[model samples]
Target: APDAPGATLTALPSLDLSRPAWRAGFDETPATVLADGAAAAGAIRRAEIATCIALGAECVGVAGHALELTVDHARTRHQFGRPIGAFQALAHTLADLTVTVEVARSAAAYVTRCGGDERSAHTLAVKASEAAVTVTTEAIQLHGGIGFTWEYPAHVLLRRAHAAAVLAGTPDQHRRALFALVDER
Candidate 1:
């Protein structure tokens, strides 16, 4: 029964990208419903993956778009007496963020191609979740303090990544799914 303590859920509750109400719902559903839930969950999972792929693309895009602007900003934005980007600290940070975003993008693309295998999907999901977190966090860091401010769009990207990580499953959730896939084998 859907009300059972460990039922596997099947139905993908209507979700609003503007909101995150399903995380709690999925957590509570009984595992018994997995028979039905798996199909629905798979569909939902696929959709979520598609969303993440698109988002990951955006992350890559922003990094590409911002590179020039960041270069100019670093060149012009004065610190104590010089441009902040000229400092090794800022340069390294930007470099690291760029690397993270690229790696995340590659991982997402690989995962998108890993179709149908539950185990693979589970692994891919976890990887994508990590990618989402890493890229978004780096994006925020590269942006500096303004990244944290609501007025900046960096927060919006972070929020979307966060939501994507939670959807279908969290990092731990996907890991468990991977284990399940192995066990099933």
Candidate 2:
């Protein structure tokens, strides 16, 4: 097959880091010498947005589960002859976490329904990533010392939230993207 006019295919070695990240570089060679690749840049962008959406959804799910675990722990873990969850501070914190998780879920679902809307996808990714990190961190706090230990799953969820937040695009980056889109309009 003939190479596409404005595209080239290069085989570059890559390294995968934590949270599904890759590093690759294209050579500075002239385009004439490289094999042309299919798919326009727009198509690639759309695919990347789709990937971000899926990753955002995963983060939301993780946050949701972590919230559930924290809630259950609060309800069952007794303190002062009563469940700690009965305390106002703990109850309010749990309520906030629940709201964040729900908002993140709504954002993810909106992006999923919107198909490949780049702005919406970016916003969703940012919101979901932030929610995951916040919810997971709060979960660890609510779990007391047990959350920090390896035996508990709070640490695992925190690590995943951190990783997911960095992947696709960081919250700051997504925010900037949203700002740019708003500026364009």
Candidate 3:
């Protein structure tokens, strides 16, 4: 072990149970006798980005499912002898949510098709993360009182959105990176 190059791996302790999240931090302590530490570091960074992209897509999928549940509720829940979804206001809001989910899905699909481009992948991550939060929030609002209760699945989707938004990178951080990318062009 002393003569050959090696990398150390450590499993960090859990942070807290109040919030559902996973985090790991690495310190790039100098590796003695290592010829190319930079290359290893770069590979690790790429892996992190790839993970972020995958999680972002997952968040989008979660939001899409939440949307479907809300729409179903709206269509079936009747008020004044008519389905609530028949109302123009609720219908329009659901339509807009559908558009957001579709756009986020497209961005996610783009990232899958072009996995080699880190910039586009990060862009998709940003879009999907934001879309998840926004769409989930809207879904909760559409679900009315029941959505606020812990017994309902809408709150679960909202909690997941909040957790995903902060994972890998915040929406603001990703937006800054996207702006920088645009500036570079």
Candidate 4:
């Protein structure tokens, strides 16, 4: 990937996230043939599966961390002579976010330990992307003005989740492919 023939490695415009454009142009450009036979296909399949699993795990981590930060902030930052977390609405939202992060974590861990099939990757992708993006966005809102600033981690997590979601195709694309695979069964 670092050096491949017929691949321009054109850098896309700056992303909102901090990640470098490590993957691009393999589809559009007729890159040099890395492999061709059935064995090669199998290797590629395995690689894609690994990538998807890793991405899902990464999203889980991101969302979990963001949620932790938000919860800490809520507990410490007070409103109307009480901690923000004491408010019923915020406490409920945090509870939901906690569930979301935990569910994604469990799914990622299950797929990691069970050696799940190709279709499992898509399911994990949809869940992880949704959870990570949702938690980080909520973190940003809950953190008030501080969340949007570079000083806080919420914005960074949001950007990371957004960027990672597009890597193995967006969540919606994966959902469609997952349904197709299921229907094929």
Best by TM-score: 4
Q: Provide the TM-score for each candidate, comma-separated.
A: 0.58, 0.80, 0.80, 0.86
Model 4: per-residue lDDT, tens digit, 1-185? 64565455666654454777744555555455778899799998888777788888889889999999999999999989999999999999999999999889887877866777788787888889889999999999999998998756888888888887777778898789888998999
Overall local distance difference test of candidate 1: 0.60
How many steric overlaps are in each model, in order? 11, 0, 0, 0
Name the best candidate (by lDDT). Answer: 4
Q: How accurate locally is residue 88 in candidate 4, as Cα lDDT from 0 to 100?
A: 97
lDDT (Cα, tens digit) per residue for candidate 1, span 47-83? 7655545544544454444444455566888889998
When summed lDDT is taken over every stretch of 10 residues in candidate 3, the lowest stretch is 14-23
Candidate 3 C-alpha lDDT tens digits along 1-185: 22233434444443222354433333454446543689878887788688778778888887798989989999899999999999999999999989989988888888878864777777777888888888888988988999998757888888778777776788788788778878999
Whole-model lDDT for model 2 versus the true structure?
0.83
**Considering summed lDDT, which 10 consecutive residues are worst modelled in model 1?**
15-24
* Better-scoring candidate (TM-score), 3 or 4: 4
